[model samples]
Target: PGRGRRAGSRRVYGTLEDLLGGDIFSDFFRTFFGDFERAAGRRPGRRAEQELEVTLADAYTGAVKPYDIIGPDGRAHRVEVRIPPGVRDGDVVRVTVPGLGDLSFRAKVRPDPQFERKGDDLYVEVPVKLTTCILGGEVEVPTSTGKLILKIPPGTQNGQVFRLRGQGMPRPENPSQRGDLYARVRVVLPTRLTDRQRALFEELARLETAETYAGAR
Candidate 1:
């Protein structure tokens, strides 16, 4: 019933006691236990380490979609924006680059504007869900400057909102119900960085003697 060796016997030494007493078996067990001990000492997993499932089903009208940012895993990420009054394709939405994060450039998704005007009312279909390339990436943008950059830190959140000042246009008739551009920061870790880049980062970390921006409670 056994393939050359029995459960209670040792194939190499012919007996359990003989195998246990051998130098090779003793060395093997010592090495195995040592590695296991080191592995068991690591920190446990937390909610932040979990993977999130996101979906986008319905198509958006009058929304802008810039070039998708590819994560380290080679996947494109899209951010949804409401088609504010008078927004069209190729219009760059100024976004502030978040500290420790990168900025997202959202371009118009639809080729033609999709808004209906009825008497004194105007309506447009907006995106139900917006995606960000980096998670927890909060942007500080200046719309008037016509220069925006998004800097997403290492840990951004999904569905977190960001606003652009004066970027929204006045409603067609009301002039008060103006629409604003919003973005959600998506977090993604790099699959891997090159050795040279890693070394540079390690060096930069070593040079930091003081805490620069650890938020104060």
Candidate 2:
């Protein structure tokens, strides 16, 4: 059993992996589920919501998630939720209750350790060596699917953002169209510099100082 997390008006059980099923769903899984309802209609007897926590991978590719709800008979009834691709956090999936109105399943997308999602776009911080930032070089960038080589032009500064087209999350409305992935440059400085490196840096510093002095004049 995993820890419970509060979602909206209900408390949900299971860890991120247990609920969303984990990274094994990396393949391009076709979504059979259709668009779900976002708003609920006025009903006389509506059951309290049961929350579901889904992973980014699960949201990326639609998967069937199993859930249990208390039936009006006071028995736990298990149902498999057909999750469509590109489902975002806060989107509710309505489950049909034999007699009691509809049971709501509020989706809570588990936060990714390496990526931050905004709408359909994804943002990631890519670490680039100081030398690579100074001189033109290629750095491997992590995407939802895999790593791609990103060329950092010469004089690329720290915090510089690069957009990789069609790399972000797929839109629920249109699975073929994707937003974009923003790769922010995080310049990593060397903690320990070799004697040769120190000497070269010293020479570069002298050159910069000379250039500044000349500019002042």
Candidate 3:
């Protein structure tokens, strides 16, 4: 569309005109030939890929999302892309740019605040009170959809992990089957023990000591 000139400075980005050289008319012919070759089932060169960042939710369920990209003119331009379901981080997705060929987009899936993904599995840490760990109780756990109650067995140790089947991310190609979710326990210690609490713990400690002595004997 415009005349081409020698580079006065390094170009940050440009259209086919920057790469093809000469005026828009010349570049138009070059693009025409390139598209023609592509349609004929041949590639002219290596395809270029642009990085796109998408929300975790969008990547999880797949959606047509609008994103802004900086153009060669240094202005933000809005473009829409169809994100496939179960698109993991660094996965590339094809994009259709008008009059442009041999280009794609690589998706950067944002991290979820509550869940950490490994392959298809998900992991989350839940805080369990000391009393709950010792006496057994139910604690609320965070999941993709909502909260669920996780039963803690008596004598549950800190850092223990519990697995919930079919609660993790869905398979990329299959939505019916899903991975597992792991909840790691983080025991919360009691602070500023009261007189009765301290006495009870002291008695428990003595009892454990007596048991150990009897075992040794």
Candidate 4:
């Protein structure tokens, strides 16, 4: 009975020594402590992620906006974020905070009413009067930058698209370069016609429907 008791004690001591001397005990404790630290929210220097809402113009022009963040100590602080030009939706911007963890900003660009942006290109619709379409005059068109004077050719048809070179949103890769702007022409007809205008139109219609017009054509 004494030898049996001694053998059991040796086996227990050997098992403990093997556990302590090898990396098994240290690794288990390290993993347990790491999990506990994470669960208890005591991890140091953890990064934070947030979303930032920006306007299309702001994204296009590149702006410095204020960002409010709550630190681990529960104090609110304001930070200035530099939004690069041509930043698109879902793009990430990183900023390092002193003592706090790094902050990541995901850009969310709002839609613009004046322009429809698609892959750096801008599209807009311009309304042109019937007389201007027929007489071929200059019409003011709205672009991403500003108003532009677009020449309307004589007998410009409705739904005609005109391409304005280098007048679009800035390219994300190269802000100095830009894309094109497509302006679709929408002709606006006269709502009410004057008596003299009706009379002249009646005469023109009579001339147009005549058999001689067909023969001439």
Predicted model with the maximum TM-score: 2
Q: After superposition, how far is residue 176 of candidate 4 from its true place, in Å?
A: 0.5
Residue 112 displacement in candidate 3 (angstroms): 3.6
lDDT of 4 by residue, 1-217 (tens): 2223122112111223343343332322332333434533545664323567777888888888765444545454566778898888878888778965565777778788878888888899999998898789999999766799999998777888999998887888899998899999998988899999989878978877565334332
Model 4 alpha-carbon miss at residue 46, Å? 14
> Between the candidate structures 2 and 4, which one is better when assessed by TM-score?
2
The count of backbone overlaps in candidate 3 is 1
Which residue runs does candidate 4 get wrong by more than 4 Å?
1-48, 207-217
The residue-by-residue lDDT of candidate 2 on 56-150, one tens digit each, is 88888877787644443544455677777888997878867566455567788899899899999999999999999988799999988889999
User: lDDT-based ranking, best first?
Assistant: 2, 4, 3, 1
Q: Which sequence of candidate numbers ranks them by TM-score, best first?
A: 2, 4, 3, 1
TM-score, cand. 2: 0.74
Candidate 1 C-alpha lDDT tens digits along 133-164: 32323344333113355554443344344553
Badly placed stretches (over 4 Å) of model 1 are 1-162, 166-177, 184-189
TM-score per prediction, in order, is 0.24, 0.74, 0.68, 0.71
What overall lDDT, based on C-alpha atoms, would model 4 receive against the true structure? Answer: 0.70
Clashes of each: 28, 0, 1, 0
RMSD of 2: 9.1
lDDT of 3 by residue, 1-217 (tens): 3233223222212453443453333322333434444533444564444456666667667877554333444343445777887778888778665434334667777788878999878899999999999899999988877888999999888889999988887787897778888999999998889999999989978778554445332
